[model samples]
Each structure stands twice: as structure tokens, then as C-alpha cells.
Target: MPLYKEIILKDNAKLYLWKITEDIEYLKHAVKLNTNSQNRVDSMKSESHQKGFLAARMLLQHIGYTDFDLYYDTFGKPHLTDGKHISISHSHTFSAIAISNQSIGLDIEQVKEKILKIASRFMDVSHLENLSETEKRIKATVIWGIKESIFKIKNIEGISFRNHIFEEDFSLEDKKATATLKYENKEENFDILFDSAEDYIFVCAFEKQ
Candidate 1:
């Protein structure tokens, strides 16, 4: 069995993390349950995708929905036929899912010092200036996660953390932050939440609109 850590935000969006060490059979089961294609290669890739899918499915199950449906849009954004919004992300051993009535996104990252070394490549000079050595490493991971969440909600790719990602002032004492994403002329506000559970840093963003 996998161990799951759940975070329930004050706004009601739920974030779930499953540290899966099980065999790949769960993946095969997921593919069989969701798709109709019987092509061998498609089945293989679909199975690979299921590590994240089953984790998300378990979360939906816990929330009291057994017959939920998932479909992807043209931009590869995952959506529910029942009208709920969902987002998923996975890294290494952990997979995460976030669901909400409104638009939401979730990302799980293993906290590592390497992220800090490469922070300048992803973060603007202003973002670089705002971080302190004591928290710079963790904050860098947070920005990486925020960028991912923004991408999921906006359903676009090629966004840079430095120029495209804009966020509210985050103090060292804050475990959460808010950000404003600028994709062309439009701006969307998102609330960011962070958790230092196990060896990973989990970040989630929910659109306030």
C-alpha cells in the first residue's frame, strides 16, 4: 500500500500526495478502467500515466465520488465531466492531485539544494533579490511549483518563472503566499500553499476568480 498525505485548504480545495512503492499493476488497472484503446504502445504509455492517475483517483474516492469521469482538453488540461476542475503532478516517488469546484493546480517536488543553484535561471532578478539565504532553497522550490500550477490552470506551456510568474510579497514567516500570473495582457490571482511533508515540498495553487 501507498502512504498518502492530505492537506485541506481553508478555501476547501484538497491536496493529496501518495508515495507509491507498489508494483506497476495499479497502472495497468487504471488504463483498463479509463480508456478504450487496445493498441499496445498506447496501453503502455497510459499505464505509465496511471501512477499519477490512480493517486488522483484515490483522492476522488475519499471525497465521496466513485463514478467521476476525466477528460483532457485540447491543451492537455484535465477536466471532469461533472464540471469540477482538477490538476495533477508527480515527481520521482510521489504523485499529487488537487480538485476543486473552481480552477486549481498542484505540484509536488522533492526539496533539494540543486534547485537553489539553478534558481537564477528560472527566477527574475527581483525574485532573486527578495529571497534570503536561510529560506532561499525552499523558496526556490516553491517558485518552481508555483510556475507549474500556473501552467496547469492556464493550460499553456513555455512560461518562465522569472518574467511570466509574478507573486505577492512573501515574508519568511509565511507558509503560504499569493501570486499574480501574467500571460499576455491578462492577469489571474492565485493562492499558494506549501507543505514540508516527508522529504518533499508540496505546493498548490487555487485561482481566486
Candidate 2:
């Protein structure tokens, strides 16, 4: 059980992260999945993806829930049968989920130079200035993670990371920030919490109440 980190947020909401160190075979046999999930996993084309999917089920079991308790709506957003809001994300070697009493979103991203290549695609480049190359990449990855979390919360079509979401100015030391989602003639705010582990950044977004 590589349950890497468990965070207890406000209002009984919780965040769970799993470091995927096991083989696909180990994860496949460790958790029970419904027919839909089984078929879904069987259809995965990549070993990395298959491992991430299985690791998610293991995370569910870590928190005493199973695949039977989870389902997706027509919009493709996952929901827990017990009515808890859930958002999930998987990076190269890490998977994360956030369960909350209110709308929530989570994302894990590997910090690498590739994000810097497309920084302007989803974030403001000025935000990267005055920082070392490594910090720039890490910060850019955090911004991408921020936007992804917000997108998971909204789940609305046509919300472009560049055109719709805006993350407030914050230094790395802050460890927290705020963002706004402007879409469909509506504007909503979200609170963001982020951290780095093993070169990966994990972020969680909670809709402003």
C-alpha cells in the first residue's frame, strides 16, 4: 500500500495520493473493479495508463470505498455514490484524488522542461521571470496544475486554459493561491493548495463557498 500522502482539509474533505511503485499485475489483483472498470482497464493501450487506473482503485480501497461506489456522469466527471464530490488526476508515476463536501479538483504533474516549452499556451510567461530555470519550470507546472484543477471543478466545455482561467500572483513560498474561471458569462473563484513531492507537483482546488 503505497498510500504516499493523506491530507485532511477543512470541512471533512480529504486528499489522497498514491505513489505507483507496483507492477500492473500487482495492482490488477489487489482491488475489485466493476465490469465497466474492468473493461476500461483492459482497453488501455499503455502500461503506464493501466497502472494509473488500477492505482486509483487501490486508493479507493485505501479509504474504504470501492469502484462500485464510484461512477461518472454524462459529462465524464466522477462522482461518489455517497454524494461526496471527487476529482482525480494521474501523472507519470503518481495518482491523486480529492473527496470533499463541496466541489473539488485535483491534479498531479511531473516538473520538467517540457512544460516550459508550452508555457505561453496556458500561462502568463511574465510569471516565470526573475526565477531560475528550474524554478521557472516548477512554477509553470504549478500554474498548469492550477488550471487543470479548476477545469476539473467546472467540467464545462470551451473553457480554455489560456482564455478562461487566471491564477493570481504568488510566490513559491506561499504554497497557496487563488484563481478565477471566466466562462459562459459567469465568473467563479477557487482556492488552490499545492505541493511538490519527488519532482511532481500536486494541486487541489476547492470552489469558493
Model 1: per-residue Cα lDDT over 122-195, one tens digit each: 76535657567647777778788877887778877766677888777575357788988787788878888877
Model 1 quality (TM-score): 0.81
The most accurate candidate by TM-score is 2
Q: Stretches of candidate 1 above 4 Å error?
A: 26-32, 36-50, 61-68, 125-134
lDDT score, candidate 2, position 57: 86
Candidate 2 positional error at 33, Å: 0.4
lDDT of 1 at 89: 83
Candidate 2, 1-209: lDDT as tens digits: 57999888666688889999998889988989999999999999999999888898899999999999999999999999999999989988898888998999999999988899999999989999899999998899999999999998888888999999999988998889999998888899999999888899988888898
Separately for all candidates shown, the number of backbone clashes (residues 3 or more apart, or on different chains) is 0, 0
Name the 10 consecutive residues with the lowest summed lDDT in model 2: 6-15
- In model 2, the clashing pairs are none
